[model samples]
Each structure stands twice: as C-alpha cells, then as structure tokens.
Target: MKNASPAQMLLGLRIHAAAFVATIIVLFAVNVMVGPPYWVGWVLLGWCIGLISHWWSVRYHTSHRTDPN
Candidate 1:
C-alpha cells in the first residue's frame, strides 16, 4: 500500500479548504460590490453552500486553515 506523509496530507487538505473559502469570499464580495444582476446573488449563494460543505467535511481534521492577516 502507498502511504502519504503526514505533512503532505495536511498540505493537500489545507490547499483545498483555502481554495473553497477563497471562492466563497471572492464571489460574495463581487456580489456585494456589483449591485443586483440577481443571478450574481445565486452564484454567491452556491459558492457559500460549497464553502459550508467543505468546512463540514474538514472541520474536525483541519479546523484552522490560514492566518488572520
């Protein structure tokens, strides 16, 4: 069986979580910045849902992803 190094696994997970959160934040900000096209709202909502799902899956194993700054 192939075994993953702990550091490699942690880095892989953090990368995915970061991407998920980044997408949500970017889309949400864009929605807020650009007033109602309406569909933008839906896109943001979808991103939020995806972010939530990502968090739920990884919370126990990898609670904190990035620095505040």
Candidate 2:
C-alpha cells in the first residue's frame, strides 16, 4: 500500500488517541465497579506507550518529509 501523507498520518494518530482515551475511560469505570486489584493502570501504561510511539513516529516523518515541489 502507498504511504499515507503527513496529514493523513496525523489524522490517524488523533483518531487512535481519541479511541485510546475513550477505551481507557470505560476500562477505568469497569475497574472501579469490580473493586479489586485495579488492572486498568497496566492497560493505561501499555496503551500510553503505544500512543507515544505513534505520536513520535508521526512527528519524525512529518519533520523529515521533503517537499515534492
């Protein structure tokens, strides 16, 4: 598949971040209801790493991109 444009990559990152936040909220609610070991923290940490990696990847690509002109 062709590579996405920088704008597309950024948009994808935003969508991923939004979904991550929404999912984390639901997970936190569930964890609270369960009243136990609180596993949502682990999920948040792991997903945060992934999200940061995604953001870094986008930033690197966009900053390094050469204009086609």
Candidate 3:
C-alpha cells in the first residue's frame, strides 16, 4: 500500500473512472439517452464512482503519508 508510486495512484484513478465516464459518454451519444432509462442509471453509477474514488483517495493518502506537525 505505502509503496505504490504517484503513477500507480493515477493509474488507479483512471481505471476506476473509466467505466463511469464511458457509460455517461455512450449514454449521451445515443439520442435515446433520457430520464429513467438512461440518465438515472448513469447518475447512480456516477455516485458509486464518487464514493469509490473518495474511498481510494482517502485510503491511499492515509496509507502512503505520514502525519505532519
């Protein structure tokens, strides 16, 4: 955990974010993209991504870092 480098951290973010971004982009690109059928799922997916990203950010930051005075 602590040994992971900055590039690793970035790679983690990119991989985690990829699905969220991809779903949204594809949904938007499709003209049928709409309320319950499309946007709702994507929004919920985004929320999940947000939560996961937040958790990973906090986890990696705390894991890699030493407390400062």
Find the candidate with the highest lDDT and give its number.
Answer: 2
User: Which one is best on TM-score?
Assistant: 2
TM value for model 2: 0.93
RMSD of each: 9.0, 1.5, 5.0
Compared with the true structure, what per-residue lDDT tens digits does model 1 show for residues 1-69?
Answer: 014444655666677668866876787677778867646666657766876675465554444444346
Models 1 onward score TM values of 0.44, 0.93, 0.44
- Kindly give the number of clashing pairs for every candidate: 0, 0, 0
- The window of 10 residues in a row where model 2 has the poorest summed lDDT is 1-10
TM-score ranking of the models = 2, 3, 1
**For candidate 3, what is the TM-score?**
0.44
Cα error, residue 38 of model 1, in Å, equals 6.6
Error in Å for residue 69 of model 3 = 19
Model 3: residues with Cα > 4 Å off, grouped in runs: 1-3, 30-38, 41-45, 48-52, 55-69
Check candidate 1 and list the clashing pairs: none
